[model samples]
Target: MSTAPTLIFTEALVLLGGAVVAAPIFRKLGLGTVLGYLAAGAVIGPLAHIITGAEEILPVAELGVVFLLFVIGLELKPSTLWRMRADIFGLGSAQVLLGGGLLTIAAVMFQLLDWKAAVVAGFGLSLSSTAFALQILNDRNDMNSAYGQRTFSVLLFQDLAIVPLLAMISILGNQAGSQSASLWMDIGIAIAATLAMILTGRYVLTPLFQIIARTGAREVMIAAALFVVLGSAMLMQAVGLSMAMGAFLAGVMLAESSYRHELEADIEPFRGILQALFFIAVGLSVQFNVIFDNLLLLALAVPLIMLVKGLSIYGLCRLAGSSHNDALRIAAVLPQGGEFGFVLFTTAVSAGLFSNATASLLISIVTLTMALTPVVASLANHLLKGEAREEIEEDFEGAGSDVLMIGFSRFGQIAAQILLASGRDVTIIDDSADRIRQASMFGFRIYFGDGTRLDMLRAAGIEKAKIVAVCTQKRDVTDKIVDLIAAEFPHCRLFVRSYDRVHSLSLRARNVEYELRETLESGLKFGRSAITALGVSEDTAAAIEDDIRRRDEERLQLQAVDGLRAGTHMLYNRPVQPEPLVKPKRGAEQPEDAL
Candidate 1:
């Protein structure tokens, strides 16, 4: 009885128990689950010495990040991703070049490490922890915000930078001549693998899922999804690229597929568990002895790394046209050394660019920064000048319908009710996160998105809609949506809610199929009720209401043709003696007669 099996089982139990106990407690304290997982791993491995072999568990745990990137890819269609090319390449490249350059110079000036080691360390430290940043953004429901998107762009480019960074390490070492050809070969192979994954995902994956779907075995679907992710990941790793990048590419290829939601549903549980384990594994691998030896250097290095990266990110974002607030938020959210830095530093040690002690120092610095990220991000709020709006995921599952409602404000909500009562299917989309959450409480299945975005409209299924209803609260937002639909989807019928009489006139001028001033009917009903409560008969009140509505429509038509002042005579603005406030006596002429 070696007890090896028992030990393995015990370790698994400990990891699970730690996660179960730690995640919720840290979340309750608002410290975040990332920090909690780190704390749990620290306690279990380094502090308590109950678990060992973090090195062996780490590679498997890293698949969590792979699945995380894949899920993120599923939200972004290729066309949408293409729109971000400028930020991804321009802003991202600038951050890496500038931040890496500055850090390398500082390292050399301060005699931190050999020039070669410093080079690798500088670039590695320039990269921020994608898992940490993304987790925080997801926790705050900010992944779809402009700040989050830009931050993600930089992170994406950094992931891309890993291949070249590893190549640089090989070049810097004595193995340069021997590995130079291998480096180029790796790049070529990575490109080929990426192309193969894209082709396979585009041509083979959906059909395979469709076939598996016909079998109707959910277990098989889950297995197939796992196979796809792992197989793609293995292919990329074999070619010297990242497993996460490969999974992300596969996900992007299937982003517009009908089965995307099913795949996400199947993969989500595994991603969560493994991702938590990855964070914990990182915590387990913390080298306390090295930290104790270089405590003073690390204290200076950690804050210095954060400060340099933050300033570089903030300045680059402003130069790239981000607002001061957005740039600062991006900086606050992303100043940590990434998990990729661990990989880079370990590789550097093997490549003879640095020693194990040096690598441990860098690793400790990275870990400390990651641990401090949440606290720093929270503190950033005090520095913020204005409020940042919360953003939700743009998941448009089950969205196609005959009636496409663009906004979910009060008017749209009431209109949606009538449509639902009539047994019509409606797909509603709104940009407001709070409104979407509130709507869910009342049983409305609305998607979160900006209606003015053509891609969002398309995702909400504008092509399948028979009627495009624009009921946004703001006049400008309404006009932009209306104009967008009118330009891109002329065949669809438009039914618009106008903010005022001027909006009504504008909509009519644009040849909208139907447009109504949102307040007109309610205002008329209130007047009708008031007149009926007085001396007017019900029939007279109704007739007067109808008459007023007809006159208002006439005035709107006139304004549409001529100008605002064109309908002034019809507004009942003639200077006359004031009317009595008291109800008229019975048998006196009613308001209808006066009309």
Candidate 2:
């Protein structure tokens, strides 16, 4: 056997290669790059045996999870998390309890396991893949949808749940002795560590980052951020908690800090590569032969586990006041065992709570279920067809609007607010119940339904509406809405917000009258400020903007024509066509010689 160090290097190289090769193919297949990573890991670890030392690869893989959790933490502001309290606390709590409890019962019955073992199994199996679900939702442009928000809420709760779960696991390990004090001590240490980190982070990290940023040394900032993550992780581990928990807390601490955006940008590339490696490591760890041997048991357990979790999630979503269709959608998306479940399950086996055979069985089941999620989501889409239509119609009929905003997000909200203030009747439609409630609180009328669906558009007064604005986060959904508007509401002026340049071009192809890249306007604002700072007169700056605007309008008209012929209208950065400084009536301008 090769030395551990050599094995580690070999495995890392293999994983890197796999990710590079598989990602593009998966993208082309419309399956997403995540699936590509999984496929790569599966091929190298199990099928090809490129990296034989799976155990040595585990820790490196775990770094991916840590980075991913950290990024997730950075994105969540306290206010946003607080607003999702109902879904996170209420529905999330129910999902963990009910799903875990039922799974525990089944484990006891089928595997004839001890109560402690069964409980561990149950709790472990209850989680759905946050990484997988989030990535897919992001791909589909549904991350800001009502269903997406609820899904994220539940995932956030699950991430937090790891704390108590770890504590309980430690407690369960010492059940033979009166070790309650140790559990309490562990919990106390964890809380203290988290508080200390938060306080220190608030006072120190941001300033430190600002100093580093001013130097314009990218590597220094990267190193400082890494130190924070690794240091926090080490401290948590010293306190007998998981490194992941510490990473998550650190992220939350930085979420509202001034340097949050900078920190995120620096950490993102590392997070992506590490997370992909982590997924690959998971693939490598799977004992495919063992799964084949216990195929019957694995098959029985997988479906039953998915069914229980799905039903529990669906019930909780409904109880949390989600529409039936949305509840069903949540159920479909989250029925599988999550990445955390695999981690917990493997830990239990290593701790002697489960046999190697059983661990392999459970892993196999979880893997199969996770693999099935995209297919399940596709099925849910078909099942929930037409439901969005009825809801949209009812909402629009009630609003009696002449203009419809499909997504009541930041951009959409501003547009709706301005129009409403201008005495224009506007109907707002969004998928997030929380957003809708908040809008209602602010006296803005909003409806809940998928905006991409034609039924929802009609329900939102599509035919009567003179304008439609697609300003959601998802490009695909935006494109879909644009197409629908062009087909059905041909006269309705279409305005869309694209996530990036590519999305803007896609919208332009659909002959959208107004397409704005979300960041472009902000970039232009910055450019104007810079020009003014550089001693350009305010009038000159304004004229320059006007000139650029005129060119952009002309480009849009040209793009519309190009879009009709081909599916894309590519924009190039060329010098704007210089306009005549002054114009005279035809045949009225004097020749230079005459002058």
Candidate 3:
């Protein structure tokens, strides 16, 4: 009997049970699931010792980060990265160099470590947690915003920055001779591996998916998705780059594939579970004893490091021409220690730059910062001027058309098609990146912009357009765009999509040239088709539909003057019979038939 199997089962059970119990409770408490998982891991592993070997679990759990990067990569096309070059190179470089320099100075001024160790530690701590920051952004649905893009660009540069920083540790350490040469060799290998992945993804992946899809076996497709993600991850790991970097490259390669959405759908479940496990694993790895021993020192150090990093990022974003709100958001999202810090610190310890105790103390500090990130971010919300929203550049290169459509959501999408088919030049704009990408694949040219902004509206050619169609999904958003247009471009005709009966009345009050309730036409058509299917002829059905439409218009006009409940009698209803006593009458009718 192998007790090893039982131990493994017990650990799995404990982890699953802990996650199940903790995530919801913390979510209900408004602390977020990341913190919940951390709390649960802390209780089960460090405090109670219900589960052991967290260190061993960490390597396996890091797959969560790898999958997360892969999913993010799917959302970004290479062209999108090209568009973000200035931020990635210029802003990212400044943050790392200046931020690392500031932290190094702080460490040295305090006599925290020797010069060699301080250099490594400073840069290491300058790196913020990609997993933690991204999770926060994703939960808030802000990953595609201007600030989010800038934040991600900085994190990406940090990931690239790790290689050189690691090389610097080799040159500064006691084992400089062998480690330096090995580090250079590893760099070469990483470059070659990256190139290989690019070629394989370009030439092999799409066709492979095509063949598998032809087979119509959904399970095989899922396995293939997993294989591609894990295989790319392992290749990068083999060449000394982070596994996440490789998976991201693979995702970028496949970004233009027609199957991109399907692939995302396939990988999402695995990414979610693994990501949760990764957060829990972070919690389990918390060294409470070390934290307690250095409580006073860390109390000073953690906030100092976060402050230095946050101020540096905030300053750099402002200088780079970001709005004050965006700068504040970028600062709030990234002012914590990163997962890569653990790798750098442990490496420094091995190279004789720092002792084991020092590494433990740094690790403890990072863990505490990771746990505190959500709270710090929450605090940042109070400091923002207004509700923060994701914004994209308003490009109107070929705009200024006959019809300007404000939103490319489902309603707008359908309306645009009708306009296009009728040979109308319609300019479409939408704020959703996913919708933009999907629409682009189908040959739709949509400008990325928020329609509520007057500048964005002007750029999209509201003044030149004969009609401005407001087709935003949300009622409030639609109202805002309509109001802005009515106020700013009063001469322009407005065609608005109404949410419901009440909304139709409100839009009418706003004096739009045209307003149609979103579901009214569809509901009427469905009823007509259903009646035609049962017994009514097509001509009769058409007449019935026309009658209903006329009655509805009449009802709306009456309701507008008399209030919502004033037109109830216009709706058709079956009349009730008060009494029917036909038994004796039936006998009288039988007598007539007999005669």
Which order, best to worst by lDDT? 1, 3, 2
Number of backbone-clashing residue pairs for each candidate, in the order shown: 0, 2, 1
Return the clash pairs for model 3, or none. Answer: 129-338
Model 2 agreement with the true structure over 1-595: per-residue lDDT tens digits: 6697886677668788999998899889866777777788889978987776666776866776677667777877767767889888888888999999999998788765788888988898888887777767767888778999899888877876776776566567655356677767767877898788778777887787888889988899899999888887778777766676677778887898888888888888988888787767767777789778987877777778888988888888888899888898889888988777766877777667878777777778778887777677767777774554323233344854777788888888777778988999887889887788788888887878788787777766777777777888887777777887788778889888888755666676667778888776777678778888998766666665555556555655555444423233343433233344322222423311111
Model 1 regions more than 4 Å off = 387-408, 411-595
Cα shift from native, residue 193, model 2 (Å): 2.2
TM-score of each: 0.67, 0.70, 0.71
RMSD of 1: 18.0
lDDT by residue for model 1 over 1-595, one digit each (tens)?
5799988899999999999999999999988999999999999998899998799999999999999988998998989889999999999999999999999999999998878888999999999898899988998999999999999899899888889999998899888889989988988888888899888999999999999999999999999999988888888888878888888888998899999999999999999999999999988988788888888888888899999999999999999999888999999999999999989999998988888888888989999999899888988878877767799977799999999998998999999999999999999998889999999999999999888899999999999999999999888888998888889998989999998876787788778999888998999999999988887898777767766776566556655555543334333333222223333334445543233
Write down the RMSD of candidate 2 (Cα, Å). 8.0
Measured by lDDT, the strongest candidate is: 1
Off by more than 4 A, model 2: 1-10, 111-114, 141-146, 163-175, 214-216, 385-564, 568-595
Give all candidates' CA lDDT scores. Answer: 0.88, 0.76, 0.86
Candidate 3 lDDT, tens digit per residue, 259-347?
A: 89999999998888888888888898899889889889999998988889888999999999998889998998898888898999999
